[model samples]
Target: VTAVIENTAGQGTNMGFAFEQLAEIISQVEDKSRVGVCIDTCHTFTAGYDLRTKVVFDQTFAKFHEVIGWHYLRGIHLNDSKKELATRVDRHNSIGQGFLGMEIFEVLMNDPHFDQMPIILETPDDTLWSDEIRLLYSLIR
Candidate 1:
């Protein structure tokens, strides 16, 4: 089953805000057995959750577990952050080039659980998306 919703574009609302809120709602459902999360890195960062550091990663993942456990994380959009933590900015830089850097992405890509999930890039400059994808792919084992 799929949960289709409108793209997040509203005043005072960050990209991932809807997703985060959706996660919360999904958590309350009596039958969440098939529920999962689709994380767009740009949106994730825009929502003020930094995935650049191990500490941040742990915290973010922890919050996901608290708000909506790991069983719900179904997909991921691998994009880089264009702004700092809590900036509420929605700019998406090419992978490895933004504030998130390549190191953290490499780590996430190597993670056993997350590595199996589909990671699509929503980064801009479509002409260079392939190159960015290749760059991120290279970081994985």
Candidate 2:
């Protein structure tokens, strides 16, 4: 099995939390070429990297590309943030109820580059997994 380092940034000093730090760590590693990122929307949004608006999305993603390269974006955690951008709080709400709405999801789904990647939902509705999953699928599909 291969170990990929995923960091949590914002509010504290975490390796993968900041795009620059994550990319820097990846660059210095011996397995730099093989290292990638698993960007959790909640973490990214909480870390002050807004993904809701196209401008913010483009700028944040551009940073990712410039630093780590898109090839290193191994996966995604498809979570919506309950807090505002740069709040540095990592609360995840259900699919569309959070601050980041369906539009961002549409963009993610339409992204051909990330098509082959895996996205996981870490919503807190444990008892409503079926409902939450269905809602997420409907939004993405």
Candidate 3:
């Protein structure tokens, strides 16, 4: 079974706000090989990990790799945050319509590291799902 680590909005002594915490949690599991991580973009951004730029994105993932290792990266919750970077607020908006913008999504879509991982959308607008999906697919190249 995979252990999907979610970042908290700093609501009240909540845990998993940092990648290190997720690494520690996964490390404590007896069978580490069976465990994996699900990175939610909005939560991560809310937790203060900036992914808007390539340099920052690489740095953030580098930290994740340093702490948790890339083998445990199993999935991604592809959502944009309504709050600004490091706001510690868990608000998800539609793709390209939030603080995260569309650049990061395009970068992720083309990144070979996440090639086969499932990228799920958690945007608030149900009406824009089709359009969002198409936009994501179009960025695959």
lDDT of 2: 0.76
Q: What's the lDDT for residue 101 in model 1? A: 76
Cα lDDT of model 3 by residue, 32-84, tens digit: 87788888898888899999977888899999899889999999999898899
Please give, for residues 30-123, the per-residue lDDT of candidate 2 as tens digits.
8666666788888888787878966778888988888778878888888787888778777888877798887777777767777788877778
6 Cα displacement, candidate 3 (Å): 2.8
Q: Rank all candidate structures by their lDDT, best first, as comma-separated numbers.
A: 3, 2, 1
lDDT of 1 by residue, 49-108 (tens): 767877787777787677766777778777787776656667778887788876678778
lDDT of each: 0.69, 0.76, 0.86
Among the numbered candidates, top TM-score falls to: 3
Model 1: CA > 4 A from native: 4-20, 28-30
Give the clashing pairs for model 2. 7-16, 9-17
Locate the minimum summed-lDDT window of 10 residues in model 2.
1-10
Provide the TM-score for each candidate, comma-separated. 0.81, 0.86, 0.94
Best by lDDT: 3
